[model samples]
Structure formats: C-alpha cells, structure tokens
Target: MATLNKSVPLSAYTQFSRAEWAKLSQSTTEILSALEREKLGGIDETISADEVNDIYLPLSQLLYMHMTHSVNLHENVSNFLQKKTKKVPFVIGVAGSVSVGKSTTARLIQALASRWPNSPKVDLITTDGFLYPNAVLEERGLMKRKGFPESYDIGRLIRFLYELKSGYAYIEAPMYSHLTYDILEDTVQKIIEPDVVIVEGINVLQVNKKDRRIPQVFVSDFFDYSIYVDAEEEDIRSWYIERFKLLRNTAFQQSESFFHRYRHLSDTQAYDIAKDIWTTINAINLEKNIRPTRHRADLILKKGAGHRVEAVHLKKM
Candidate 1:
C-alpha cells in the first residue's frame, strides 16, 4: 500500500501493499482463457494472469463472502419477521476517471464471478448507456462535458437499480454505442435475475451537492460493494492520449463512426486534440468530480507506472 498518509485521517481504511493483498487469493484455478483475457483488456490496459491472480481473484473471493453474508442476513431478518425471504442481485459499482480502465475491471469481475462454483449469472452495465444522447447534449450545451455528472440521466438510473434490488426478474437498461457516440435508440441490456450486476462508469461513486442534503440517495446507495481504480492524473492523461491515437487507426477508420474525421489527422494534430480534450474536459471532470469520490469506494486499487496496481485499500467495517 502507499504509505498511509499520516497527515490526514485514514482510520476508516486498512491499507495493504500489492503483495500483501495477493496472498489472500486462495483459488488455485485459472478461470480466464487466453482469448478472454485479451478480449477483457482495454486498448491501454495491462491485464495479465498475474494481475488476475493477485488483484482480481482476491476481490472476487471477498465479494463472494460479502454476498454470502448478505444472503444469510436477509434470511435471518425474514425469519424474525415471519416472512418469505426475497433475493436481490449483489450490485458492484466500478468507478474511476476516464481512461483508468474501469470497464475492463468490471468485465473481469463479471467474468470471474459468473464462473464461481455455483455458476452465478452475472451482468455488466456501463453508465455510458445511461448518458443522454449526443443530440440532447448538444442542445443542452454539454457536448464538451459529456462524461460529467450532468450528462447522465440519474433519475432513470436510480429507478432501474431500484427495480433491480426490488427483485424484478426482467429489467432493461438503456444501451449506448461508442461507434456512433450516442445512445442506441430503443436498445437495452436485459438484466434477468442476475446473481451479480457490475455497474461501471466514471461517476458511479459521485454524490452530488443535492444528494448530500437530507433524504440522501445516489448511485452508490445501490452498490453492495464498489471499486475505484486510481492513478496519478498525469498518468491517466497520457493513457487517454495514447488511446486516442490507437483508436484513430481502429474504430475511427469506419465511415459510420463518429470520430471518422480524425483518421486523416497527422500525429501532431491527433496529439494536440487529445491533449486539449484531456486538459479542457476530461481532466476537469476527474479533479472536480471523479477523484473527490475515491475515498468513498469500498476498495481502492492504486496503480503505478505501466498500469499495474501497487496498492490496495479496503474500507474498515
């Protein structure tokens, strides 16, 4: 773990170095196949067997324990009330800054979680789907701040989660397509009685000013556990720029893609645009919105250079 900052109070968290946390992974089996490992990683992400064994396996193990405990607790409370026990999906929120590889982490969790001995049904959803359409963003003058809190339909998201935890067997969440850079009209991700649902987004841990008042409610309220992927701001900015360059040759080449115009840009132009986007928009969102919620996460995975997690922090019970 990064040395506990003695200057600030951290009594509510237990910090562990990467090696210390890895020791807790008791599962000897490798659950991810080679193709799956490649598919699960993002363009700029480094997802290796070592990372899965050391960081993610222990997390999945811990999540299973939490799920088991919650199930038992529900049964106990139901028994005391002389009522039937209703099951709810274990909700795990993965929150982080853009380019921090949160989506990859969410997919890894869903993958490992579903392969548990009991074969639990796991579903993963990204808040990008909940983002207001690009046209709506343009009309609202928020196109530049598309990933910020105001860009999301918080009420709808809350309602979906509300229904999910209420044990709705068939729930549909809106879907977005990055290729078009917009919400797919009438498209939805069907979440059918999942044992676990992983919600991934840049703002999953955010608690807006209005939410801090009495009768507080936010996305984190629906999470049984949450993970925050952390790295220095400069590192994240570099990753964002690198990913943009890579996408220029890949996703941006398609004529139907929203970013197709960028394919013809020279390296210098691409770099400049990517840097400007980071400095003017993404970085501001990170500092003002995302980073502020880091400590609010149940688990914090702090990364070092090369996108490797070097420390872990678990919130004290």
Candidate 2:
C-alpha cells in the first residue's frame, strides 16, 4: 500500500498492499479462463489470470458478502416494522478518469460475482448510454463537452435508478454506439430484475452543482458500494496516448468509426492529437470532477505503471 502522507489528515480507510489483499482470496476458485480474460480486458490494459486471482477474486468475494449483509439488514428492519419489503438490487458504482480501465474492472466483477453459488444475476450499464445524442449536443453547443457532466440526462438517470430501487420488474436504458459516437435513437437495453447492477462511467461519482437549486440527489446516492480506480496523472496520460495509437490501427480503420479520420494520420500527427485531447479535455475533467470524489468511494484500487493494482484502500467500518 502507498504510505499515507503525514501532512494529510487521518482518512476513514485502512490500506492493504497487493500481497496482503491477495491472501483474502486464497480459498476462492479461479473461474475465468485465459481467453475470457483477454476478451474482458480493454485496449492497452494488461490483465491476466494472476491479476484475476489476486485482485478481482477477493473483490468479488467482498462484494458478495456486502450484498448478503445488506439483505439481512433489510429483513431485520422490515420484521421490526411489521411490514414486507421487496428485494432491491445492490448497485455498485465504478468511477475513474478516461482510459483508466474501469470498464474492464466492472465486467470482471460482474463475471466473478455471477459465478458464485446460486448463480445470482448481474447487469452492467455504462453512463455513456445516458449521454445526450449528437444532435442534441450540437443544438445545445456542447459538442466539445460531450463527456462533461452537463452532457448527461440527469433526470432520466435518476428516475431509472429510483424505479429500480422501487422494485420495478424491468427497466430500459438507452444504448450508445462507440462506432457512431452517438446514442441510438430507438434502441434500448432492457434490464430485468438483477441481484446486482454495476454502473460504470467516468462521471458516476460526480455531484452536480446544479442539483442544489432543486431536490438534492446525486447518482452516487443509489450505490450500495463504489470503487474509484486510481493512478498518477502522468501514467494515465501515457496510457491514453498508447490506447489511442492502438485504436487508430484497429477500430479507427473502420469506415463508420467516429475516429476514422485519424486512421490515415502519420504516427507523429496522431500522437500530437492524442496528447492534446488528453491535456485539454480528459485531464481537465479529471482534475475538476473525478479526482475530488476519490475520497468518497467505499474502496479505492490504486494502479501503478502497466495498469497493475498495487494496493487497495478499504473504508473502515
């Protein structure tokens, strides 16, 4: 674990090094194959079976424990009140800066959690689906700020979460396409009753300032557990550039890809563009919104170079 700075005040978390954290999963069986790990990992992300056994297996076990505890707590409260309560989904929020590999983390957790005894159902959703369409963004002149907090339909997101917590049998979320870089107009992803819902996005931890004028409720309120993937700013910037170069050679080659124009660019040109985007947009957003919420998460996964989780910071009960 990274040593805490004496200058900083005491935190509510107890830190654990990677070796210490890995010991917690000694009894958990490895359920994913090498092929599955390759498919789940994002571009430039170096995830392996060892990482699964050391980092994610323990995490899945901890999450399952938390879910069971929550169920028991609800049952006790309902019994005392002499009332019945429906089962509510346990929502987990995964937040981090762009290119921080949060999507891979969320998917791995979902896969491992589902393999537990009884085969509990799990659903994963990205906030990209809740982003405004390209047409709407152009109309509102927010094209450059597409990933900013203002680009999302906060009301719709809140209502969907509220309904889920209200025990809705099924809910639909809009689908977004990375190739088109837009929300599909009539497409929706239906989520049936799930034991766990993992909401993954860069801004999931953001608390909108505009909410103060109305009833105060942020999206993080719906999360039973939250994770913030952490890394140094310089390391993240390099990873973003590396991922961008790889995408130019792969996904950007597709004619329909939003970034197809970059596919033909020389290596130097592409590198410059990637660096500019990182410094101007992603880095700014990280400093302003995402990093401020790291302390708010129930758990923090601190990654080092090569995108390996070196330590875990778990909030003290």
Candidate 3:
C-alpha cells in the first residue's frame, strides 16, 4: 500500500500558470455552457461560468491524468502478481470547513469528469448521507455537533467505500434528505461501475481515532486523490453565517425542514443566532477535526475573503 508523504509543506507544491489555466478553461466550453444554463434556468445557485472554467476544468483535467496514472499503477501491480484485475474506480475526496464551497467544487468536478471522453461514468456521493440520523444524535446529546467526526457512522461509511473500491458490480449507498436533515433509510442510490467517484464532506481526511494515535486507515486512505478547500477561519465563519441567514429565510421556512423554527426569527436576529451556532459548533469542529487534515490533502484550493479560490496547491508526486 502507498502512503501520503508529509515532509513537504503545502507552499512547496507547484501551481498551474495563468495561461495554462486559461487554456484549460477554454477547453471545457461545453461544461461551462451547461453550468451557465443551469444557473440561468434557476435550477442552481448563481455562480459564474468563469468559476467553473478556471477551477473545475483544470481540476477535472488533473484528476483525469491522476486516474489514468492510478490505473496504470494498478495494472502493473496485477502483472507482478500474474493476475487479471478489473479497472477499479478512481475515488476523489473533497474536504473543507463549513461554507468553504466544497460542495460546489465536488459538483463541478462531477459534471466536468462525466463529460470527459475517457471517463464518462462519473459518480458523486457525499458523506452527509452517512451522518447519523438527527434522532440518534439528539439521543447522544450531539445535535449541536452535527458535523463532528463522531456524528458519522464511520464503520458503515468505510465498508461502503471499500466495496466500491473493490469494484462491486452495483454499489448502493443510502440517500439523505436535506429538508429533514436525516438519512432516508429506505432510499438507496445505485452506482454502476463508475470510472471515477467523488466523495465530499467535512472530515474526509481525518485520521486520528481519538483513543488511538493512528487509525487502521484514514478515511482518505480510500481516495485516489483528495482536495481541500481552505480559507481564513474568520472568512469561513462569516460565510457560514451568511448562508445560514439565507437558508433561514428560504429553506428553513419549508414545513418539512428540520430547522423550520429558525425561520421565525428576524433577519438581524437570525444572523446573530447563526453566528452563535458557528462559534459554538462549526468552529469547534473545524479547529479540532477538519482543519488538522488539511495537510493530508493531495491538493488544496486556498480561498480569499471573497470566497474565490486564490491559490491552487498541487502536492508533489
């Protein structure tokens, strides 16, 4: 098994030049057009095509090359053992603090990779689906720490990824409801043999298991590649509060939403409430669990105060 070498600092990693990024952007015009269409049709939130082009295009291209290299390596290993092995899926993990735009990164990469000629069968599964049910968390007095590492069913999540990595014919993962904020027990999304699978979450790179200094395997151990979205803690906190206010006015007002009661607060009051939640729950999770794993990411998209990706750090291979 291969291990992630941590001797080099993230700053030591090289980045794509502006001209190269532009070229990658131009190459993915089709993807950008589709993304624009979604935004215009009001099906998606308003994020620019330039954002998708400049970031996700280059991101998917790099992932494609990495997946190709991984396949070659797997084949070489099989040859050494004199056994025929199927082409396993390339797993990519996207990790970050709350409101760091990791979801957008994951969705953009999925769309970009799915359109690639070499790897059309791309799939995405969020670790959110594996989060313990709200009832269970409430029972354990962990409702406030919803995004914490212990809030997830790590064993089941690991088993699901293991089966997928082993090239199972059809792997079915549980579905989650954002409105209810709980796992949908009877619902499953079947992923047929995909060439690439993107897994996105808050603690995807967490390795330490609390009681033990090292876990048997890091959650990121299953990943062929991993990306971390990074920003200043203050910037992320502000963004989290802003998003919470938006949700409180819109999504939270929905009858089925778990946070429906928060919608009753006025905008200013809601902002204050959201900030308190951030300072108490999300910030603690970021400091203790999420941020520590930044060093383990294969790449990091460091963001500025405006929530735009400012620097791309590609790990030395």
Candidate 4:
C-alpha cells in the first residue's frame, strides 16, 4: 500500500490514510447484513464485512451529508427566487478500469445510501446498458473496442441523462445481459423518480472527443459528485486473470455463456487467453481512456494489491 507524503505540499486533494478514514465511519451504522454483502460482491472480488465497515460506511456517511447539503442549497435558491421547484435526483458517477471492482463499490453505495434517512429512493444503473448492441458493433467493426467511448451510443446516453436531470416522470434504459454478452433489444429498466442515481462504468468519467465541435454534454457533466476507483495496473491485471479463471470454472461451463468455448480449454490455455484479452483490450483502454480522467473525480478510492481500499483522496473544495 502507498502512503501519502505528509512533508510534501498537496494541491488538489487531501489524502487520508485507511485508518484515518475509518474514524469517519463512527457516525454511520452498519446496516448491511452478511448476505447483502455477499450478493453485492463482484466476481472474484473479496468484500468482507470489515472492508464494508472501514471503507463504504464512511463513504456512505459522507455522501449522505453531501446529499443533505445539496437539498438545502436547492431549497434556499428556490426560496430566494420566491418559487417552488421539484427535486431532482443526485447523480453519482463511478469510473474505473474493468475488473477494478467499480461495480461492487457502486452497488454497496446504493444499498447504504438507500438506508440513509435523507435519501430513501436509490437506483443503480451501469453505462454497460448504454453500449451499442453486438450487431451494431459488428457492423461498425468496433467489437474489439467495445468498452471504448466511441463504441457507445453517446447521443442516446446523453439524452437519457438530460431527461433524468430534467426530472422526467419516467425514463427507460436499455438492458445488457452478461450471459449473452450483448444488449437485450426487448428489455428495458424503468427508472421512476429516484432520489439518488449511481452510474457505474469504465467510461463514465471520460470526456468524449467527438462532442467537442458540438454543444453536446459529456456524461460527467450531469454528475453531482463523482468517484474514481484506482489501483496499480499490474494488480488490476492479476485480478482480471483470476476473475477469468473463476468464470471459466463457473459461468463459462454453462452452454449459454458467451465464453463457453473456453470452458474446455486447459488452465494454461485459459490463462493465455485471459492475458491476451487483458493486454490487448482492457489494459489499453485503461491507459488511453480511463486513467487520464482520474483527477476529474471529486473523490478517489485507491486500492492496494489485494483489492482493499488502502487510501482515500478527497478533492479539496
């Protein structure tokens, strides 16, 4: 685990040691049960009750405070203008490299935030739902760059966010299936007046270069607060390989799985394929797209080799 340099002058963020950050969790209660944590855990990602208490508990407490303050600010502005206004959802963007546990973090935060008295209606949506269908990607010859920004339906995703922020009565998001490894054309997730919306993905914080010439808005612009999960590149690669192996033994064994063909491969063959995918696709995307936007986040959760959050960096206001 890397420690912050106390002797050096900090510019953008105030770094907190894991022990120091755990103290903030004192004000928040542990509402998640063992079963809930297990359900929220990502593939091959270890998230014990202790990790939740030390990392996510404090994070949830801080997010709730931010939500409360934002509501009060809105109310004050509305009263100053002598007008009544409807409340909009507070959007939190979570961005990180693939297999970095951003999904797990988003789910955990959603659960904790819902339990908070200030915001009871919480919804979690991944930008994976906004990815173009495999058929479309194949047509565009972008199957290799599936997780890249250019591979998404950015225009549609932007419109959805605009509608969500505009306080629309109902918004429908397309569904993506992991089993089929494609966007489901017939299914949609209906979001109805949520108090909080957590959008998690590899490219949530990315600023699209294609939108530069136009007045189109990036997804991060709609976020009230954003989090970027961080870890060493090598550590993330190892985790990705481990997850691939686990899936090979479990999900890949199912005939319906997209990667079912790999189930019959030997351990060495499976390892080579996972390594190739990580190097050619996931790692390249991380270096080129995801990591450059880390500084844009309001908070950063830096993880160590074992996928534990070893330190926290809060952007200085």
- Which consecutive 10 residues in model 2 have the weakest lDDT in total? 1-10
Q: What lDDT tens digits, residue by residue, belong to model 1 across residues 1-317?
A: 24232245556789999999999999777768778899999987858889999999999899999988888898899999999967899999999999988888889998989877778899999999999999899999999899999999999899999999899999999999989999999788988889889999998998767544577679999999999998888888999999999999999999999999999988899999999999999989988888878878899988888788998989988
Model 3: residues >4 Å from true position, as ranges? 1-12, 15-30, 34-45, 213-215
**What is the lDDT, from 0 to 100, of the residue 262 in candidate 1?**
99
On a 0 to 100 scale, what is the lDDT of residue 159 in model 4?
93
Expressed as tens digits, the lDDT of each residue in 1-317 for candidate 2 is 23233235337889999999999985656579888888889979957878999999999889999999988999999999999988799999999988888999999999998987758899999999999999999999998888889899988898989988888999999899988899988899899989889999988888877547677888999999999998889889999999999999999999999999899888898889999999888888888778877877899998988999999999999
- lDDT per residue, candidate 4, 115-138, as tens digits? 898657999999999999999999
For model 1, the superposed segments whose C-alpha errors exceed 4 Å read 1-11, 210-214
Clashing pairs in 1: 1-16, 1-17
What's the lDDT for candidate 1?
0.89
**Per-prediction TM-score, please?**
0.95, 0.95, 0.89, 0.94
lDDT tens digits by residue: candidate 3, 28-72: 444667544364321223456666777767887788888878888
lDDT by candidate, in order shown: 0.89, 0.89, 0.80, 0.89
* Cα RMSD for candidates in order: 2.9, 3.0, 3.7, 3.6
Q: Would you list the clashing residue pairs of candidate 2?
A: none
